[model samples]
Target chain A: MMRRFPQIAPPLIALAILLVAWELGVRYGFLKPYQFPPVSRIASGFVELSTIGFPTGVSIWSHTLTTLVRVLLGYVGALALAIPLGVVIGSFQVLDKLTAPLVVFCRSVATLSLLPLVIVWFGAGELTKVFLIGYGCFWVMLSNVIAGVRYVDPVLVRAARTFGLHGGELFRRVVLPAALPRIFAGARMALGVGFMVIVGAEMIGTIEGLGALIMEARTFYRSEITIIGMLIIGVIGFAISAGLTALERLLLPWAGNLDAVRR
Target chain B: MLDHDNLARCALRRSEAPVAKRTTSPFLQFIAINSVGKTFAARTGSSISVLDCVDLTIAENEFVSFVGRSGCGKTTLLNIIAGLEDATQGQITIAGRPVTGPGQGQGVVFQQHALFPWLTAVDNVAFGFRKSGLNKTDRRQKAMDLLTLVGLEAAASKYPREMSGGMQQRVSIARALALDPQILLMDEPFGALDELTRIELQHELLRIWEAQRKTVVFVTHSINEALMLSDRIVLLAPNPGRIKRVFDVDLPRPRSRTEPRFNALYEEIWDELST
Candidate 1:
């Protein structure tokens, strides 16, 4: 514990020093409190949003929950469709060659650039937001899944052959396990893309998400509320990523150096 | 020590003995290679011969080693026997039937321990029994038995990466033995280990071979390794690989490197390799 204290102490101290300097700068009039928002104002803003509500009706929790639900629905839906489809496409050479150019072109188009088209097709509603998030996540995930299956170690395939394992048995026993670390890396990357897409996506139509809360606060000249909403979104993003990392570790105990496996 | 010259003469006389025909029973010729050849097509659209007209007969329960330098087709010949690779111009028969593909009861141990990284030692061994009709519990029990035979019962639950190279190789040997193959083909299985570990594994292999009495065809570049384990050593020469010579090692069991006769035979084989 004593040895680990040095490792953890430096980061905490740096963070504390940064927060103190920012607070002092605002309190002494060196910085505008309205624009920058002093720590005290942001703290009060957090309390007010949680209890007295943001727009006199919905609390900060409701906005955060709405944002989270949209992200989850899209993320899970994308993974559900992409994983099986990616596996099939990855396994067959004919299918992979057929779909390669299409997948690359689809992934290249900026996800947010599709916002207007999606809004026109599905209307400016929750479906548009979910569809945008799903679009951002699906291509990233599908490419990773395909690469994972395609690049299994040739030596491992030969090893399995010596055991009389071939075809489906070889794929199941050797290829799948060898490709898992890569697949997990793809999932993590897709989640990050989804998180970034959601924040931008929520700003367009909805007024009940964290993104909209901040946008609305800005229009009303409640800079402190905007600051609080931004902080909450950052925290939620961090939590989601950390949760996924923990889940990956728990599921694949054998997969080492997951970050190194990422392309 | 006896005179080196006398030992050389003795080894030469022993080499002339017809070891392959020692077994009188017709069924004893367990594996027969008849003019086996291998050719690979290059990207330039021309063929390169890897092995040419290789013929040999291995008796049942015999320990034979194929020794040569790189590109000698020793490993290729072993793969052909295992049915992992097809010979271009010849046929190999085991137990009166022609070779087809892997799973005809030929168990192979590669130079690197090829145990599945995701599986624990026991599960890797049990993989050999996947085609067997045993229940899961029974398969685990049998795998445990093979691990015990290889002196690794304690490491049954450990993953491949968690174990040392020697331990990993031991697990691989156990996995191969789990299949109870009629013929065991090992391609330099102990080549990567340190000298002490290699010698230890050689002893362990001899003990297991004595107990199970399975035919073994081992491939190695080490002359001493072949001399230590083989009843007969088939020397292959590269540059269009072909059998150069076959030596019948009539040395007694538990052969020592320090023995003058062993040294003499080693020098002769070393000379053969150089040429």
Candidate 2:
């Protein structure tokens, strides 16, 4: 406990010092409270958003849950479609070559840039937002899965072959397991992309998410509420990545240092 | 020294008491390699021959070792015998049938212990029984038995990553034996291990071979290892790899390096390798 204090102490002290300076600057009229909003105002904003609600009825909880639901839907949808397709593509050299250019082009196309076209097509509803997030995640996931499958240890295939395992049996038993660490790396990356896309996605034409709450607070001069919303988004993103790391650890006890293996 | 006197007597008795089929040679050739060759395409577009016109015969239940320098195609020859790689020009026959592909009663242990990381030691061993039609429980039980045979029963539930290098190689040996193959092809199975572990595993391997009575073709760069384990050692020369010589190790079991005969043979092989 005593040893850990040194590790934890520096960051806390720095944050405290920063907050005090901000409060002093605001009180001395050197800084504007409306823009930066002192720490105390942000704390009160958190309480107000949690209790009396942000847009007269919907609480911060509802906004967070809505954002989370959108991300989960997009992320899960992308993984479900990408993994199988990627495996097939990665297995065959002919197919991989044929699709390589298309995949690269699609991944290079910025997902948010398609928002205007998507809103025109899908009418700026939940589907439009979810589609944008899915589009962002799918390409990242697909490419990683393909790479993972393509680069399994050749010695493992030879060993499997010696045991009368060939064709699809070899792929399922040997290739898939060997590729799993890379696949997990891909999943973690895809989730991050999904999280980033959702925040930007929810900012436009969506009133029931953290992104929209912050945007609405900005127009109403509630800068403190906006800051609170941004903090909540950051916390949620941290939680999401932590949860994914935990899941990866749980599923792959045998896979030591997957990050080290990944490029 | 091992109890070789009794073993020699037993072999003599078995040969004398053998039934009807009479042959000029006392023991039948288990694996016959006839003018085998291998060539690979070079990056410069010219073809490079790795093995050229190699020929040899191994008797049933005999332990043979292929000793050679790097690039000598000893591994390639072993792979051909295991049916993992096809010979460029010649044919190999096992049990009177021509080799085509993997799965002709040939169990191979590579230099690297290629046990699947995801599976426990038992499961990796049981991988040999996947197509044998045994249910999961029976496979696990049989795998446990093989692990016991390799003296790794305590590590049956451990993953490959969790085990030491020597232990992992033991698991690899157990996994190969799970097939109940008539011939075991080992490609320098102890090459990556330290000296002590290599010697220990060498002893363990000899014990297993004695009990199983299977035809073993072991490939190694170590002359001492070849002398210690093999009934015959075939020396291979590189640069279009071909057989340079074949030495018969007629010395008694568990032969000592201090013995004059052992030192003489080692010197001869070392001189041959140096040239």
DockQ of all candidates, in order? 0.44, 0.62
Shift of residue B7 alpha carbon in model 1, Å? 39
Native contacts recovered, each model: 0.42, 0.77
Give the per-residue lDDT of model 1 (tens digit) for A54-138: 8878899999999889988999999999899989998998999999999999998989999889989998899999999999899
Each model's lDDT: 0.86, 0.88
Q: Return the top candidate by lDDT.
A: 2
lDDT of 2 by residue, A1-263 (tens): 99999999999999999999999999999989998899988988888888989897889999999998998899999999999999999999998999999999999998999989999999989999899989999999999999989988888999999888898889999999888888888888888788778767887887899888888898899999888888888898788777877887788888875657433
Pairs clashing within candidate 2: none
- Expressed as tens digits, the lDDT of each residue in B1-275 for candidate 2 is 12344345434543554312323352565787766778999999999989876767788999999999999999999999999998877678897788998889999999999999999999999998887899999999999999999899999889898899999999999999988999999999999999999999999999999999999999998999999999989999898887777888888988787889988999988998889
Indicate the residue-level lDDT of A185 in model 1: 84
Q: What's each prediction's TM-score?
A: 0.89, 0.90
What TM-score quantifies how close candidate 2 is to the native fold? 0.90
At residue B33, candidate 1 shows an lDDT of: 81
Which pairs clash in model 1? none
